[model samples]
Target chain A: MALSIAGAGRNALTEKAAWFSESLARGLKVARAFDRDQPKMRISEVAAKTGMTRASARRYLLTLKSLGYVGSENEWFYPLPRILELGYAFVSSARLEEFVEPILQRLSEATDAAAHFAVFDNNETLCLGSVFSQKLFGFFISIGARQPAYAGSMGKVLLAGLSDTKLEEYLASVRRVAHTKETVTSAAILRREITEVREQGYALNRGEMTPGIVGVAVPVRNKDGTVASVVNANWISTSSIKAAEIKRCLGPLREAAKQIEMRLASGAVPTGWVSRER
Target chain B: MALSIAGAGRNALTEKAAWFSESLARGLKVARAFDRDQPKMRISEVAAKTGMTRASARRYLLTLKSLGYVGSENEWFYPLPRILELGYAFVSSARLEEFVEPILQRLSEATDAAAHFAVFDNNETLCLGSVFSQKLFGFFISIGARQPAYAGSMGKVLLAGLSDTKLEEYLASVRRVAHTKETVTSAAILRREITEVREQGYALNRGEMTPGIVGVAVPVRNKDGTVASVVNANWISTSSIKAAEIKRCLGPLREAAKQIEMRLASGAVPTGWVSRER
Candidate 1:
């Protein structure tokens, strides 16, 4: 991404954005510094993480602190709830959260399992919305967590939606490593699984990505029948799940996917509709 | 808030933050224009909503489009998922999510009802985390959704946590309109309810905020014996709720609150430990 930005001449997107207020980007970067791994950062630490000098970091931190985005305590600084407005804008604008949220919650409530809606971005499954059941303890999953697309049921359902050539290209380039004893390691076996998933209209995974966790996924399609995302349900236990147990979820999961498809047809998705419709 | 900001002199927090990046704030304002009511907007609409000139709004929109913060479809523009990084920072930074999440899910799983953790912010309750049940169609509520502090069980629990002076002053200024026929409109009645809540250690309400919902909230305290937030469970239906049903939830709700208090004492809350602990 940086290479493309640098290679482009004047009037490039990055150059134009940085033309007026560079501090805007800097302030945003300061806000971006906090994430799951490093939620709290010291003044010196922000400087190191973002490659800004200590003075520059301090000035921006002080600016953000005043702006209500950054909250300071002793030497450590963290973000406050107001920062969520930024994210809320995206969720509201896209209108994805409104439609997917209730469906996922309902599925979780019905099955007593963790339910999720994930989109295939780049090569990973980005969890957009999730409702976890506390049957045991849930895995460390949160909204926006990315999982490998090659080793899970949700990813497989998404992969099955791709055209033949794209699917073949993905299989050729993707790293085929076993995440667990039950993971499919060979390209040939994964290709067969994807084919089966396409025929069955769902994917079932038994301890593939994480040990002791089983998953089932179905594809949510656009009006044109192209896949937009995947709806997944996960059970966190090593006990072998009977086929009937996994089958019991198929009807509700497909119902949700169809409802999402219907909603997407009515201009409820993030990816533009009217333009594509026209 | 605006008066205090204007009264402060040069180098005040707000002033310093605004000095370098006024347009940044304007861009943020434009992004916030998208909400549940209006998820899409045109350039002219954006200008009207944010009071930015068409030319300036165009520039920032173009910059955001290039920066991947905004997506354009037809003539309307909307925010993209990249904005979520801003809010994800706060959720991660506090680290409260790691502990509170499991307990909320457990409560929801057990009760088959919506369970939420809300903190008193301004004159409202800001939902920090929630696990919703699919028992009935839920109202449009999100993680950051705020409810009036005078109208709901969650709000009353937080209000009951305040000191005598603060509570009196809050009651004096707050606009108390009846949200439902059963809402406590009289300040004296509400005060008595809060006092009873303080004595019993929890609050229960039926058809107070929404017409058909029954709610019970318990206060989660810090080690210093101050209330930090409220844990709430809501049952949806117009059916009259008996005192015993509300009573049944208290034991589990209080248990979860105590668990949260224990976790908060072990360095779990967002506020800096040294300052708050002191």
Candidate 2:
């Protein structure tokens, strides 16, 4: 089906799309080559990762540079801050704050932990908004950060929100690699866990995605009662604060999620309502 | 020269040029149509703003959407969060933060006010980052927001850092619109203010940009002693916290800026330092 669509697009753009045709694939690859770990790249580095010629990579880099999306200093190329404007534009305008951010903030303050609001994109989860606790030693995940959907507390909650058929298809496709010793790598185990998550109306992860990190997540439903996103609070566990304490934190987390759902239902979810359409 | 360049660009593309001429312009226009204020737009809105047909806008939107740079929901479109990956890719990786964010954060804390770090971009000033004090009543400006270089404390500080010739040219080109009652509008007054700001090692705004707000700013110097950006702290003046209090806050603000400068000299800036690059 994907091949047929590509073939049809090719036929449709034969004469007019030639300029973009060659660079489109290379551009997408170039964008993917940039990540939190490897943000800046040399022409050679980009070429190696994207499997493009150095010359092609250079062209794309220069093009991006001219567009003010990339910066070059002393021969090393890096993505520039203007790129954040794109994300900020969406998130800031999306009125998510009216519904989501305050709830996340209150949850973080209540639990004294980092709280995150995340949505599913394909098989991965993207953190849309986040609030950091005042505590010095809490989970500090940057906004716009991504993680696999099968692993963490918020990821599992979002995954559970999917239809059973879609969830099964996703499980079949994923490798379910263990992130920590306690991570559920088996598809059957994950399926059962997601079922429980759905039944209990929340999900929990203890040292699953990251060591010493414990979290509980609940889905934020939309006006139609469909799950829109997952809100999670993460904290570092010591002997003083065990899994049970973390579970106790879930009550405020769920309350905050419910509040956000009510805000969304009231149509107060900010002007840039991209999540609703997605 | 500009007209000649435009004419040359209008000429036929080289055989190496891959995309259709109109498609390239349409794509660029679609990308440009999004700004800090209007980050998301419907297809008809984009068409209206870019002066392109809805079909052309849809084509560009689909192309960008496929690349993961643009996103859409229920026919409403927005730039995506990954767009920040580009800007942050450069800033997070750059040494700019060694002398920027820390100073701003410390200044904010010391003053119990809001501190901003901004850099010059052409004729405007772009906010690199800001740190707000724990106090509830502080200025709320995001990291990527832009302001006219001729107005505001940070803007004037950055303007003072420019070369004399460039400063003269920019001053000639700018439209000195008054933002508040105390805004400096006359060229002679502004020139004198800039000169004083240069000599005093800081700039002060007494309710110039926004009424009831007072700001003090100092330039952050790079390793080569060139002014890289400006750091400013903002506070509200009432009977309790007068202008004297605001001026007193500059002491710690300057010390913080100096510490950041030392960090920049030591080249100890963190990896993945994304902030406003341009």
**Which candidate leads the pack in DockQ?**
1
* Tens digit per residue, CA lDDT, model 2, B1-278: 99886777656355325432334335656755776466678989999998988787777877777656677778778776555444445445543343355556557767777778776764677776665455534355555666787778888888787788777887788888999888888888988999999998888878777777877888888866677777888877642335577578778878877876776577555322222222
The docking quality of candidate 1, as DockQ, is 0.47
lDDT of 1 by residue, A11-128 (tens): 6655665534566667677878987677788989999999998887777787677566677878988877666667777666666556888887677766777888887755667677
List A-chain TM-scores for all predictions: 0.77, 0.84
Steric collisions counted per model: 0, 17
What's model 2's overall lDDT? 0.69
Compared with the true structure, model 1 gives a TM-score of: 0.84
Candidate 2, residues A1-278: lDDT per residue as tens digits? Answer: 99997988788778556334345546545644765466667999999988988887877776666656567777777766555554555445554443455667678768877788887765777776665555524355545567888878888988888888888888888777888888888888888999999999888877788888877888888766677888888878743336676677878887988887777677554323323323
Q: Per-residue lDDT for B9-113 in model 1, tens only?
A: 544755565444675666667767777676777899888888989877777776666566677978888776556656777776666457788888677756667
Question: Evaluated on chain B only, what are the TM-scores of all the candidate structures, in order?
Answer: 0.81, 0.79
